[model samples]
Target: MKRSFSILSLLTQGTGLLALALALGGNPPARADENLFGFVRGAETLPKGHYDVYQTVTLRTGKDVGVYRGWDSDTEVEYGFTDKLQGSLSLVNRYIYNRGVEELDDTNHLTFGGFEGTTKYRILSPFKDPFGLAVRLETGWLLHDEVAGLLEHEIYVAPEIIVQKNFLDDTLITELNFGGEWAWGKDPAEQYYKEFSLQGGVGVTYRIAPKWFVGLEGHARGEWPLFNFNLFEHSVVYAGPAIHYATERWWVTLSYNYQIYGHGIDELPRTQTFAEETRHEIRFKVGFNF
Candidate 1:
């Protein structure tokens, strides 16, 4: 059944492409979302034929104790395929080392890549005026896991609706983007589970100069596990300020989100402790269009 659903995901993704190709038929370009550092939403204006690149390194402080050291890194590359279509690929690597252990009992590392595709449909053009509505559909596929043979792979299908309004001569723009995601995965224990995710946020951007702008944003995602991983359910939220620079074919963003707190765990049933840790991390990304 899990394999069947995976096949369905590919089939539905193809169907979405067909719908986009037919619906786009020379339609006007749609506006893009605006969370700079975290998962929040912003009222960002994007022109056709534009590209962006994002790169960032995050350091986790005090994650290590006298027994363990932890580090993680993620690299994502995304492109605007059209005025309303975007695609991305990401590589993530994580490491955990025993602080004072050796002899094949001290270190672990895992690396994986994810593929994603997204499409946006503008119900109304915000550029012509100030108020508009839009919808976005996206999906992702996680590659095979090397460390956890019991962990197969997972997929997510989500749809989001966004509303934007510009006030005070476009200097102050406010936006609300909210949506839900469905996730499914296979466990090495020959079990399958699914979950639902709720994502939403609000943000505003200010034009500091002709080509520069600064903005503040916040977003959160909550999930409830309903099968193999029922013990893994939590919510994560983040917020911060981001600076955006725009050019014809290239755009760059440098933003940071402070610890708003959330939660997740790779292993089930902690053997040493029973306290829930609030999820916190910083992410930096760059995007380009060609």
Candidate 2:
């Protein structure tokens, strides 16, 4: 177990360095308003009366042979309570149709919901330079019923920082985002089934036009046994390109994600047979605000 934990720590650090290197190697394009933290969009480009709504369909494919799935939708709604302060809520609903599973415990997959709230403050505007910078912090909690039992919840604490710059009449801009999450209660590492995880990610966004944008993001998640097998750990790497579109009060995004899982976690000293697992998934996201 101790050996497993050590390997995961080293791998996570190595992947983080790689992400930094990639970000630096990119072309030196014109700077724009960018947020260096958080996946949730704050004021972005909205006024007081405007709100936004988003929905996404995600397709997940397992590593094993003959494993396929359907579209899983995630929905979110946000409203500008005030200019700098906003309130938002998100929920996920999906259908899982797996082939060849003999009477799996969770059926059809109905009845699931979670809630989160974010407050953003606009620190500064683009001024005459057509560039802006902002700092924001938000707190949220998650509740999952199917995992353990009803009323059993998972806790997530996230603090983020974001920076945005606008260039060439806002037609072209760049964004930088970075943040970390500390999770507890319930299994934070889905594959391990029981463990606490600390994870962080960095992302950059480039706007091609008024309604079109592209992004490159890299994230790392590491988990260690909190209760049993305290020395065991696991790490994962995810990076991909994403697209965004907006129509009045509605927004949508689509992307392909590639994921790599490190070794050590699957090779338990007690368990003789080692299980190797690694794969990719296609993610679709749609959102709206009022």
Candidate 3:
């Protein structure tokens, strides 16, 4: 199914941001649920009964073709059931505009993409414990392929292990994440297939100023046609820099990633993966705590 959002969503986002601007003078945040990196996740969960609203935008372009551009807008709400457990729900809207792409036909459209549910459990606290550790599970159903922009019926589950460490009296922070993703879906042609992928990332962040952070992150991912790696099809690597700012009521993070290396099914991708990946990606996120 292809879904589309009306003007109400744009109005909602605008109003929410306007509210955030008005509350800039509110007391600083007492919680650590804010995001420090764009692609990497930290091992921090919200305190019990705490709620946070987030808006994330992702841009994927540079497909080595003629003017290919895609954007995803995600709106998410997160709630903490306990100090160690947190859950979130999100909706994704997708827009694509392309012309004269070698692989893709000319198209311009904006549609509702999908929704997802995510749960996280913290086992160690980076602030109190020697190091932080957490487990996160994400389940989602989508109607469109993430990179290809093709219609499909796909349900996926991704489980990840997250670790965090703090140094320099909390001025410097590091996080590592590794995960496996499994999906069973019908492609655009209505053919069923099972896909699996292994992905990992590492990130380092340092406080540059009050409530401002600068970070670097790296990511690697490889996919298989089935559950085993013997059928591996492609892999990609990305490295990037990120900037983040947080306050008592709101936080925003922005990042840019460049495809570093990859391998495709038929050929080795020297600098990037063009078959199923993009050469450049940009992400921006803003969060409000309630």
Candidate 4:
């Protein structure tokens, strides 16, 4: 069965709000320190005594035939606890649709993906230091069955280091992120497993106009086997372009990524020689700062 709601539908619904914001704007302010795109985190924290609220939507399609399609929406709230520290909370929802599953007649499911919390601290300021440096800790719980028909009861912890540099009067920006996730979970069949993954990303953006920025981002991820931690089960790389638009009160970003390379079990085993991996992804985010 086909679902009536989709990522496109969600974006369409928000068009009116975006138009309204555009109508009420002045020249966009200086760009924030956040990365323009990709999964990378930038080494900037919110200004003290400020709040940011945002929503993000992501769509992913499998590289292999007869795999799965996934859509996710996340709502997040963040507060600047101090000049050097920030905290955030997020709620996630997901939808998954399976293909080529002969055993199940109904191949689509929508469910709550669960919640996440994050804390970040800046160790060095780009304004004074050579580069911006920060560390972030994130944890999340997933108690839903929307992913691959798996009732995943998982707990995951991720730690990330963010580095940033700017040049030419802060018009040209660069960001780097290194992170890893450790997860333990029960699968759909009640099989318990532990997994570890490593990820890194780099992004560069140039402020072309006061309110507009364009950038390119690249990301790489590798999955390690549980028992034999030294061996990677698969690896993939993605690269794409991103655009950002911001006004004094609100901002929006859009990015698209396509897998450039894959190794080991990257596609589904039966469908291709590799395990299933994301072939393409699109992300959209809109936020307000107060």
Question: How many steric clashes does model 2 contain?
Answer: 35
User: 2 or 4: which has the higher lDDT?
Assistant: 4
Candidate 4 residue-wise lDDT at 239:
82
lDDT of each: 0.56, 0.52, 0.87, 0.77
- Best lDDT goes to which candidate? 3
Residue-level lDDT for 165 in candidate 4:
90
For TM-score, the strongest prediction is: 3
TM-score of each: 0.62, 0.62, 0.87, 0.81
Candidate 2, residue 205: lDDT? 63
In model 2, the Cα lDDT at residue 182 comes to 54
Q: Report the error of model 3 at residue 47, Å.
A: 0.5
Return the candidate ranking by TM-score, descending.
Answer: 3, 4, 1, 2
lDDT per residue for candidate 4 within 176-235, as digits (tens), equals 999998877846523337678888899999999998889998888887756356666777
What is the Å distance of residue 80 in model 4 from its true position? 0.7
Clash numbers, per candidate: 11, 35, 3, 6
lDDT of 2 by residue, 227-285 (tens): 34366565666667777776544556666656754444545443111122234557666
Per-residue CA lDDT of model 3 for 140-248, tens digit only, reads 9888766556787788999999999999989999999999999888476233377888999999999999999998998889988867778778899999999999888
